[model samples]
Structure formats: C-alpha cells, structure tokens
Target: MRTRILLAVAAAATLTIAGCGKTPITPADSSAAIAGLGSEHVKVGMAYDIGGRGDKSFNDMAAAGLDRAKEELEIEATEATPEGGDDEGRLGALNKLIDSGHNPVIAVGFQYVNALTKVASEHPETTFAIIDDDSIKADNVVSLVFAEEQGSYLVGAAAALKSRSGVVGYIGGVEIPLLQKFEAGFAAGAKRVNPDVKVRTQYLSAPPDFSGFGDPDKAKKIATGMLADGADVIYAAAGGSGAGALQAVAAEKGATFIGVDSDQYQSADAQLQPVILTSMLKRVDNAVFQEIQAFIKGDRAGGTRRFDLKTDGVGYSTSNQALIKPLTPKLEQLRQQLYDGRIVAPTKP
Candidate 1:
C-alpha cells in the first residue's frame, strides 16, 4: 500500500484533512518491511522539539517509537535535544547527530523546517524525516505529517459534552498553522455540539519565539486566568506548558483539564492525572515508527505520508477510566461522519 505524492512545504494539495492529508501510506508489504530491516542493526538519529523527552507529550511519543525500533527491529538509535528553538540551535543539534555518523536523521517539529531544508539538500547521501511538517520538497526527506484537526475535533466534542460550565478554554504552545489547527477543530467541535458554548482561546507565543511549548509558568498563569473566567474545562495544546495548566487545574478543585499529544492521565505528577478529563491522542509514535520502517526498507523517496483516523494516527486517549465512556457511541458516530465527509474539521483559526 505504498504510493507516492509530492508534498509542498508551503502549500497543501487537495488531500482531505480528515484522511491524514495527501498520500495513503498503508503499511508497506510486510515481507518488504522485514526484508528491509534485515538482521543487521540500523543506526537511527532524532532531534527533539523544545522541552525534549521529559515534556511527556509530543517528544516523549517520538522517543517511544525510536525505542521500539531499537528493541523490536534491532536498530541503534540516538537522540539530541536542542538548546534553543531557533534555526541555529536546531541546526547544531541535527549536525551533531550527523557528525556522529547517524543517517536518516529525524527532526521532531516543524520549527526545524528551515534547518532541515538547508541541511538535507547539502547532504543528499543522508535521509531525513520531519514530523508535523511537510513543506520541504527534498527527495531525501519524508514528511511524516498527520490530520491533527480531525482528532482534535473528537476531543473538542468531548470537552463540550462534559463541560458543566458553558465556557471552555484552549491553551496553545505556539501560534502556528500546526497549533492553530488544534484551536480550530476544538472550537469547531464545541460549537457543533452546542452553538452557544463559549470557547476562549489563547497562545503563549508565536513562531521564532518557541519558548511557549515548555514554559510552565506562563501556561499556568494563562490557564489560571481562563479558569477564573468561568472556563471549567480547559484543553492545553502547549506541550510541557500543558503540565503547568494541569497544575493549575489540580489546585482549582472542581476544574477539569484536557491534554494533547500524549495521555496526561499517566503523568508522573499523580495530582495531574486525576484532573485530566481526556487527551487528544496524537499518534506521533506511529508516524515515527512507520517512516523509519519505510526508510529501513530502502524507501527513501521524499513525499507526504498522511496518518489519520484511518491509519490510527490520532484519537482520544483512554488514560482516565472512561472519561469519555458515556459519549463513546456519539463520538464514534461523529468520527464516522468525519471519515464519510459529513464533518470537516477546520485547519485554520
């Protein structure tokens, strides 16, 4: 089920947003996948987004995939975290891995688009995968992007259904098309469920100022303000900043917090766990594992590989015991509607 479609980094083709974008990258034939991963150990490298591994969100899921590739396919993988989110910082981290003789380097965030585009062309001998971004048109780079808005719609519906207060809040790490899609689907879903529901949205920072993803203090303050304004249910799409929002939720007694990317219900902070009503489970792990798997199979063509509801790339996490259980039937109906073209989650603010 491997087909190829050229993806533009700056523009998108007519791929359905609910279907993981343009290409239908079903798992490559199993025989080829196994043969591609012969008995030899494959060396894989990764550069994480800001906040790195302990962020317990996007980067952690990327780590899980790399770890699984090592354990199951006998690959030797090393990861590097950037000191800053700027192009220079990301370039240094990527160059460090390349210097260590790592091939098929993986850049975990769209913030690395500039660095990856420049470096990938300079080193055609190496292969690279960029998660959450597909603007690069290099033949050596694979765009491991997902239909985030589709899954976000599901959780947004959940938030609307569970909110005792008619108002809900959304917190985003950075203001970009990537995070903006989350905001769009969330607000859309809430409005779809109940037209009058007020959805307050805020972004901690904009592009080039990528500190928002890991800034707990600012996220906490933002969440505190949103909750104080009658937002009983809040969703945080700000990576580690979400942890701070959860902290605020924990202190607010009756408030509920929704997580994004990873399952916040499994947080190390036990107090944060119970406060998490649900998480928009974006399967960063699946996209990472599959792209790396394809690379192993000698499939290094640069193009768009879409992961969506059909590919199990995104959904609502079951971290808490049935937080969305009562709404499962309705959720499933809405999910099918998304797939069948009845519902279209917006990708813009």
Candidate 2:
C-alpha cells in the first residue's frame, strides 16, 4: 500500500561494465563454492515487472537473460512476479526469492527500487540488481540501466522518415520522468530530421497507477485516435500496452508501429509483423546476463552499470528489412554520431 516512490532519471555519466579478478566458478565446482547462495547449484532469482514473462516485451527480455544464464552458465533459477503488482507485492516477491535460497536476485523494473532498498538492507549479504533504475545506493545492489533515449532517438528518426503524414505519435505506459526520456528523445530525433515534424504524445497512466503498462485496450483507443489525427508512424514505450498499439497500427493501412524494450516484431503475431517498422532494442537480457556473469565470477561490487550505444546496449531492430532498408543508411549515420559523442540524446521531455 506504500505509494512513496523514487523516480530514476537517466544518469549523465556513462560507465562501462565492471570486471572481477576473482577465480571463476566452473560449472562442476559452482555448487560447492557458492555456499550461501542456494542448496544445490548457483541459484538466481528473477523478479519480473508487472506483466511478467509472457508480456513479450520487457519482462520477456529479462526472462530470456535468465534463461541464457541458466543454459550457458549452468545455474539454477527461480522466478516470481508480484501478485498484487504494488510496492508491498514487490517486497514480498523479493523476500520469496531470497527465502528460497536464491542469491543475486534481479528485479526487472524500476518500480522495485523502494522494495529493493528495504529488502536489500534486511538481507545485506544477498546481492541485488535492478533494471531501468539507479536510485538505490547500497553496496548489495547494482542498477542495470540503459540509454533509452539514444535508441528511441534512432527509431523516432525512422518514424519520421517513414511517415507520409508528417505527424508521428508517442505512447508512454506511465507519465514518469523515465518514460519521458523516450518521448523527449523521439521528438528531438524527429525534429532533427524534419524540423517541422509533428509529434503527438500521451500516457496511459500516471504515478500511483501503473496499470497503464498492462492496459492494452486503453492504448488501442489512444493509438486509434492518433492514427485518425494523421499519425502514420507511432512509437510505443508502453510495456505490454504496446501490443495494443501494434494491433491498431496493423489494422490501418500505410501505418507503422515502433516497438520498445525488445525485438517485438519477432514475438508479435504473424499478422501484426508487417506493421512493425522497427523496435528500439533495449538489451535488458544482456544486462541481466552480464550481472549474473559478474556475480558468478565472485564480483559482488554493487555499483551502477550503464548500457549505451557505445556498448551496443540499445539499438534498432532490422526485422522488416524491406521497409527499413532505405532508412538504414541515415539511421546508421545518426547512430554513429550518437556513439561518437557528436550527438547527445535528451534524457528528459
């Protein structure tokens, strides 16, 4: 029932992935080595965001990372989602994971900041990593964040280049500063390409109401309105609600949808694939994998790690090659500018 929350704005300083010199835990000896972690093999806990694993977007990417660790690194894993989808639920989920002997628990959303802050203090020995948030300043916690604006900027330019109506739309799951980064970067990129480009923006929900991430029906209504208003290209950063935008865009001829967090076109339905012009790939899976990899190597430093274009942490998908091919050259040029520090994407709207 706690409504208090700390909003995480993107950090300005970019840090590379940290490395550890501790002896690596081989698959055969990992079980006996990680004594306090779990009963058997090295066990990791995954606490998913609102829509959980099957969301086919953010949460799914986190799951994919965990799955990769399990297969490649030979680690045991247990995953859980918030039953009530609130701060209390987040705390409960974390507690459940730790109680089950899973160490190095990864909370797959910024919404877990408060819950993680409390649980982390209680379990000082248990290492924790939070995705999309860097507000926690604890030794046992690491913030796995991404340069969302950079990726969003590229897609926004793509949206503008692909738009015939001169107006593009942005849909945010919630009206938080974090989500604002996506809107800001998208608008800025669009304007950079076409100074007179029109950007339509809206949020499905506000603070204390995170239901927006899961409410596709409302997103559908909003996207429908944007399309009717002459938006030919729409970029949705609204978690699972983005599925609705994809469906809406699919039904409208000559309209395109930009996906976020994952390569949504691959996970999207076969019929909805064509409408997906491109997706802003926030490599949450790679972040999760790196966190687990560092942990297994006995690197317990809970410092913040930033994933940006320099590290290939975020990017645009190339699934719809035919549609995106023509725009590739320009997009790649813009991407290089971002990577070379020639262009800096806005982190705020």
Candidate 3:
C-alpha cells in the first residue's frame, strides 16, 4: 500500500481559501451533506491544525489536497478545526468525524498524534491518516511523513548564497523537534556553502503552547532583531506567524525572506512578494490526495509512507527570479548531492 502512495504533487491552478467553489460543508453538518448528496457517495473527513483552512501555510496546503479530492473523486467531504487547546478537543473532533461515518479520516499536524492513536485503537474497522507524525503503530493508521529538513537544507543554502552580511536567521513557530529539523537543516546548508556563515535562531514559543504557530507579531519582532544584528537573509518556518517574519524582512532595506510548507512567495500578499527569496516546498496536499485516492480504490492498508528530496515530495520553490536565477546552478548541484545521498541534511540543531 505504501508503494501505491508515490505519485506526483497535484498541480493546484487555484489557491483560494478552502471550499471556495462549493457551498461550505463540515463534519458536524453530516445531515446537510447527506440531504444534498445521497449516502451512496463516499464521504471523507479532514481535521485541520491551529490556523485552519485559511492559514495560507501548513493547514491551507492540506485543504488544497482535500479540495482536489472533492473535485476528482466526487467524494462528499467535511472539514473540522479544533477550538480548544488540549488533546481532549482533538480527540472529540476525531471521534465526531468517525461517528459521522466518514471513512479514511485525515488529521493534519503532529498535534493530532495522541488523539489519533487513541481513536484509531478504539475504531479498528476505520482507517485514519496523520501528517507529520509516524509514531502510531496501528494497521488502520497511515503516517504520511515528510523529510522537511531536506527542503530546508536547500533554502538554507539559498540564504547563504544571497546573504550580503555573512549572517542569516531562522524564525521557528515552536522549539519542538519538528521545528528544530528546520533549524538544523538551514544552518547545516548555510555552513556547507560559506563555512563562516552565521545562522541565528529563535522560537516564538515552546510545546503545549502552539499559539506560536499563529502569532505573527512575536515572529516579526524576532525577525526584526535578527536583521538589525546583521542578518541579510531569514527563513521562516513559523506557519501563520511567517507573515510577520516576511513583513519584517520587507521593511529592512535589503533583507530577503524564505518561506516554508507551501510556495509562500506565490501565496503571500502582492506587496510582500518581492522580498521573498524562495520557499521550502512541502507537498502535504499531494500526500492527502494519494491517501484519499487509495481509500476510494478499496486499498485500506496503512503504514508509514515518507516523502523526501529523492521523491520530489520536498524541494525549494523558484518563484522569485531576481533572487533565485543566478543561484540556480549552485543550488541544483547541492540538490543532486542530497538526492544521491552524497550529502545529508542534519536533523538536529
């Protein structure tokens, strides 16, 4: 089943807010969905992370994948976002979606790890997919994990190559293992090129307090400090807070910013686009589409499936020509080294 999961990323021609083209539907509104479409149609459910559908970063990428499934598979889809901060809220949402009879439910973010593990155990007959987590040891649970460090490594190199001050910065949403992966890759990639380059780092928050992912003000403050200290390039892996980081870089006379999860350059506001040097692309939408498509084909087998530099599951974006054009040759050389195992991005900082 894992072998069947390897497919190209879905090309999203449109990046509007989730449920943009259709009347909005949610898992709790199963009755409304049933009335509009018969039960004979397949129903899929997705539970979004902190900022939900319109985050324009992590969660939005997941929403795009679900949207594509709705269009191509004709599946009745319902989306839900948690309102509380604890695992209880996540557990309730998962239970509610499963009780609503939506099969192959997909949970976004590692925050859902414990909740999904408990729920998947109770509902052995149901299949579940989780992104960014691979600890669940159940046959009904499919762990769709990504090598985020691989992409971060590429953008880290880009930052070093373009840095005029010999210093770059990394602003993370949280000081967790996941965000650390980004910090590690970025620093490693930068030093790999310039050796003397300095990579400054800061986290907006720590574990059990995920608000950092959504707080742009704090991120901006941190980015501004880094820039003032001589960082001419900064990479943000701070989810919704990344907007604040980008804003800080834009205000700086010559600072450049790198984005994460999706093509932040493409998704960012028009006024903020030029400051974006490049983005580390993580194809969560592609993973979601493959999971749903597999379910529709009656393939319910579940296990850990990984997407990384070798599989094109993760890479750097090329949207900002002014910053990326001259550096392409060097970046590509490092990319090939990563793909061929000649170079490995450190997973820890």
lDDT of 3 by residue, 1-349 (tens): 3433554432222222110011112334333322323234678889987668998889988998898778755788888888776788888788888999999899999999989989998999999999999888788998898888888888899999999999999999989998999999999999989999999999999977888888999999999999999999999999999999999999998989998888887788899999999888887877787778667656787788787765456788888887788888898888888888999999999
Best by lDDT: 2
On a 0 to 100 scale, what is the lDDT of residue 184 in model 1?
95
Candidate 1 on 1-349: residue-level lDDT in tens? 2345423120111122322112223343434335435554568999998778877899998997787566545578889998876889999999999888898899998889999998998899999999988889878888888788988898888888888889999999999889999999999988888889999999999967888887999999999999899998899999888878888888896788888887767765775677777888787776777777767767788888887676667777655765667766777788889877788889997
lDDT of candidates 1 onward, in order = 0.79, 0.83, 0.82
Quote the positional error of residue 198 for candidate 1 in Å. Answer: 0.5
lDDT of 1 at 272: 64
In order of appearance, the predictions have TM-scores of 0.89, 0.88, 0.88
Tell me model 1's lDDT, rounded to 2 decimals: 0.79
What would the TM-score be for candidate 2 when compared with the true structure?
A: 0.88
lDDT of 1 at 125: 92
- Tens-digit per-residue lDDT, 1-349, candidate 2: 1211111221111223211001113345444333443334578999997778899899998998788678666798999998988899999999999999998999999999989999999999999999988888888888888888999999999999999999999999999999999999999989889999999999999989988998999999999999999999999999989988888999999999999988887888888888889898887877887777667767777778887776557888888887888998898889889988999999998
For model 2, the stretches where C-alpha displacement exceeds 4 angstroms are: 1-40
Q: In candidate 3, residue 344 scores what lDDT?
A: 90
Cα RMSD (Å) between model 2 and the true structure?
7.2
